[model samples]
Target: MKLSRATGTIATLALAVGLTAACGNGGADAGPAAPVSMDEEITLTFAWWGNDDRAARYEKAIDAFEEKYPNITVQTQFQSWDDYWTARSTEAAGSALPDVVQMDAGYVRQYGATGQLAELDGQVGVNLDTDGVDETALASGQIEGRTYAVPVSLNTQSIIYNATLLEELGMEPPADGYTWDDLVQWFADVAEAGAEHDPQVYPVGDMTGNNPWFLQWLVQQGKAPFTDDGQIAFTEEDVQAWADLWAPLRESQAFFPAKRAAQLEPKTGLNSAEVVAEANWDTLMPNYTAELGSDDLELMPIPTGDDGKKMYWHSGVMLSASASSAHPDAAAAFIDFMTNDPQVGEIFGTSKGVPATDAQKDAMTIEEGSPDARLLAYEDARADDVTEPAPVPVEGYGEIEVEMARLSEEMQYGNLDEDQFASQWFAYVQDTVKAE
Candidate 1:
């Protein structure tokens, strides 16, 4: 979290191949080694993206690790999310990636396909310990046929709301089985009540242009954003239907206007309690609670369709070893410590989202009334409702997300209507996916 900008030249791809030979003894073909010798000295570079709070927690966890394994030392590096990726990309290109790298689902496939990450399964020094972890959650980090990463924690999407504001408005919070119509009505009710207190206050933030939200909506309708083969899956009519659902809210000011919405950050508006509700990842509950300076934050199941809940648990993020790591064995040991160690889980809490392993989850001592407890309870109550997650997005999926945001903003600002937005988005997806 002590973020510093790093600028360096990209390493040549040939350098990557050379580094792999020097560092990759823990590859799939290598036989497992005995427990690390106490006298053996090894050092690893661990990198991740987080804020000051998380960095502090990790620092403590690292100290504990070093105390336990006095022969192994870890050097830590961190940056803001955007800067972390920029640095990682440069390092990856130059065959200078950290021994352990923090990876996101969005980039996992891209990196894995490019041979930038180590194949985790059957690796000599790695103990992924999938026995107590949800198989689907663990599988989230696999790409093609190789296990490239291990989930650090699990998360699911939910409707996070300002519980205090809803209570102040004399409204009961939404229930678990809330439908899409129920959500729309709730938004309207909040917008109507909010006008009396602050004319500019809206029921929700500007999320009309968000790809994840749209993707969830599509999933609820029994459609997918992209097919298993990585082509656009939803029809043009499906996109229009989604747009039409929000058109009325935009017109009635139930949501933030385009100009104002674009300016709002995650720590403002809905996240900060200025809006009554927003759709976001459940892992963000603590951040919202901290930002609002109150424990009055609550999460509800996302609105469902006739088929029931389409929500599925996913890896919030993952820890992956670099194929070019000079100390692959040490890197794998560090990953195992992070994922399977109960003490580490206690230190991390829900900072990275809920621990993925059952033992680590049970070991976590979240205060009874805390946001972390509430999230776990929410997840437990809806465990039976989870469905198969959509496929891990393919390469070039980022471009589709950008196009969606742009067209959504166009529709919101009246430059394009629902039909036009849908047509354009469909055409773009068709061209992009087909070309791939």
Candidate 2:
């Protein structure tokens, strides 16, 4: 709702819309006329996806952004995850993207490469400071050498396990140097323990789990998804190596069966019946625990290789500017004000992972005692994984991930022998990566 200029300067409460955006020439086609300077009054439409909780929180964060900066007003849009991407990609294609939208790291290459985003290199934000934010995570927005967005949060990779399950099994957690063989044995032991007690909960993985699903495995050493260039990195052997970890699990009854594993692979949300533990990014651990209806989940380092090298991949959620934005500097400034600012961090809390800055972590209401506040465990788990470099080709990026999955699936289901899969995976990856 538009507010009278007389009601000017009031705090903009997130949900309450404490004040209207300071737009001028309201009937103009542009919605809000561009201002001459950062101090000039303007209103921008900002969109994002989330459920009721995220919607409410984002509204408040927007309110906080507006209230703190009188000259700038932000109108907010919220939706579920599916709708969020649909609206973003569709509208962006039509030149109708909201002035500022939340950009996930995975899509940085996709959208940023299409010139649908703005460059965020060196931009400042309230809650985010590029310093403590893992450079690897922050770098997810870089395509070639140009930066397209800023990762507002610093989430890393690791495996999330069931602490209670460990306790029940009379087992200690996987130590830092544990290998695939160690995990195989561990799962067998857990399964036996579960049978001794409750007949239902298996020591093996729950049938429907996804994520922590694909990432850092022994196969990782065979070949990467993409190589030195922006092309595909693995051969069939690489694929088999990825599958090898789960292969034993399936054979020894340590993980879900073939059909069950397939059902759990593409999950965007976490819940029970998925798996007792799923290897995934460290940033997601807290959220997974919160979603699982219990705090039994805990963080564990990714298993190491015989050489003692542990591997993991890092992806950043970043903010990018639309190459088409006329107010590029101001857009850059807005990126700076929001993500780099501590107050903005307070408003965001762990909603996006850990705040991008240490100051925000200090001011956060998510106390150390809270399950959601367990940042230290995440910090420790990520201490060892080798962070892969981040870059992407101009197109065909989507195919790489899909092919990676396909090759992995073949290995998991025995369509390809481990040796053959590794050979093919490495060959394909070397070819694709070198081409890119």
Candidate 3:
């Protein structure tokens, strides 16, 4: 499952359409005509994947959009992350897809290549404001040099830690610019401290099966995880070394056991305070703070490489229009409102990630001492050290993500040794990319 969930804040633009303010009232003097009026009333089905909390936020945004464009009624369909892709794939096969759909980078190429998604650029009756949007983030939504989607927000990887727990154990928190060796030693020390404090509290949460963590490590080693043409970039030896790096930590109980980690929700172990630290996206910091019921959580840059570059990327959820939609204009209008409107940003406020546009970011008022503020501050501090994002993954990349998790788990549980796991994983990746 794509673990990226909706969370973030931004500002809103003034309503551009000249529709009547008597939106929901069936009255004679309802309002003026919409800026871009349709010949007939049209209904569009907008779909997305998220939890209940995200659904509520989206509902509010959709309601506002409906009020602005009375002739365009949007029917919403949302589901949990696991069920979303299954339904979408099915819909695609039948040429039946929602008009506006929430998208992720991992699946964009796959969907776009199949002609299931509409090209946003040069599309009739669609006007997207690209003026102040982050170019890097906007570029992530493109395939073969044509825009197929618009990024809703931006996020990057970070190591979130329990500052309260570290202080309780009489350990200073790791500082920015910390090295991989520094992190390893700190985890080892935390494990040792557990004996005197609470042995049940491990130093780090389990990330042995996490693809993003593995990808970051590969980037830190100065290797692209995949080539521009979508070939596997690392060698079997590289995979073995990565597996070996975690072996000692697993043996020493520095990380939660594989079984226990698997049982927990993705990225929740740190929020629950079960482990002192975990690798996660910076966008999720707000969720962690809320779940933990404390403000002591802090975001740190992921460990850097020998060249001192932090291997970071612009990551977040995106929205796209379907090629088969009867209401392409309305779909594009809704996407424009969602991405460029300040009111939507105010309502969402870091639930999706940081706002992707400069206007929205400036208009946002992150509360003092809030998780959103902390995340934004961390980004500001590390702006210079951040590297260019990796190229968008190819069509079969989603399959590789699943394979990575399976292989990593096998290595963790002793089902496969380092060399065996490396060989197997490499071969599987080669086959997957080649098939694409």
Candidate 4:
């Protein structure tokens, strides 16, 4: 239902392709009972990144929103994953931005901390219902102890398997009881099956592939990815364990090559999918209907470790507004409507993962219900498991992908042994974090 977008890569290149528009304000005033939107007849702009699936759904909702608010006209612009952010940020710095915009979890903090972002606290977000949203997701967008943006949803990462592929391979999908050895056995089976069909899948996550998989492996073994207070969480043995995990996985030909992966268009990684399974956001399922057709795909939680540990990535965006926006109140209103309003989640559909609100999450349609159920179950299953932010106060916040890209490429090619790869990774962490 989601693409394995290692958080690092997804954040960096995701903003490259340009789909943002010259933005305008909606007439929504926070000053008095006169909501700016109700007082004036005007054109409002909104921006986001997604495929046609998202465009179609969002535009439809916009049309509906306008029909009810005849005085307010909405100008909507969407982009492929690459260009969405650049356009928004550029517009923000330039003082020309949409009234409502899509914001990311990490960017919200950095932007809010720097004063480039707005607070959705005025008339715009005054009516938001924060009940039942995951605190962790909310925290990511909060900076300096102030809320910047509201989350659209909580998207947990999981291994989506091709039911048909497993059936043909004479194998059943991995379940909660399976441990590392069980996964290795499955990999072996995939190798045997690869002789005839596509083997297991990897999202070919960018800089994210650089650490978390191994970190998750460590977590499975009762270790942490980072320290309790933002320091290195494990030792060389942890690195060795990681090397043991992914290097062999690459050696066994368990994943895809970087070339084949790099050529994939952003927001389109899952389009060419043929392998058995890959990591992705839960929200994309309903939105990317064209890619993942009805009943052809099934979602499953990532397998547990031998120690019964599971980990997740909260791949949701923590939205914040531009501090310079003249209509901060109006922007805040839209934020509340988007995250708290059930229809907005239904409109966005899995574009940014599952809705963060309980009311909206509970109102999922039958088609949306099954996958949402799987997502909630996965969240519950790994509620205690650890998860780390892929990006932090590092220097090369954008280049972590390049580092990961190199390692992932080498691993896929089997150019280095597992231990060698891990050693290389640990060294990279050392050199990279220091530089950051």
Top TM-score prediction, candidate number = 1
Task: Report the C-alpha displacement of residue 35, candidate 2, in angstroms.
Answer: 12
Per-prediction TM-score to the true structure, in the order listed: 0.87, 0.75, 0.84, 0.71
Clashes of each: 1, 46, 19, 33
Worst 10 residues of 2 by lDDT: 6-15
Model 2 spans with C-alpha error above 4 angstroms:
1-36, 122-132, 203-215, 218-224, 227-229, 257-275, 305-316, 384-436
**Candidate 2 lDDT:** 0.56
lDDT tens per residue, model 2, 1-436: 3332211111222212212212211111223323225466565656665677866666666666666666766656666766677666666555545556677766676677666775554343422235656566565667766677776766655667777766765777767678767877776776666656553345444221122334345234543444333444434544554556555565655554456655665542234534456656666776766667787877776666575354533543456555545444455556666666677777777776776657666667776656665655566455556555443332444445555556656655767755665566556555554464
| Full-model lDDT, candidate 1 | 0.74
In model 3, what is the error at residue 349, expressed in angstroms? 1.1
lDDT of predicted model 4: 0.55
Which is superior by TM-score, 1 or 4? 1
- Across 105-176, the per-residue lDDT of candidate 4 in tens digits comes to 545544555555655444432444555566666655555446666777676555566566567767677766
Q: How well is each residue in 1-436 modelled by candidate 3, as lDDT tens digits? A: 1122232211100010101111322111222213346556766667788888888888788778777777777766677777788878777775556667899988877887678887777542345666666566666777767788888888888888888888888887676678877778778898788657764677876465577777778877777776554457788788778777776787776776678776886646677777888788888878888888989798878776457575565648799987766556667788888888887887787788888775667668787878888988987777776665645677888888898788877767868866787788878878887887
Report the error of model 4 at residue 326, Å: 1.3
Ranking by TM-score: 1, 3, 2, 4
lDDT for each of the candidates?
A: 0.74, 0.56, 0.72, 0.55
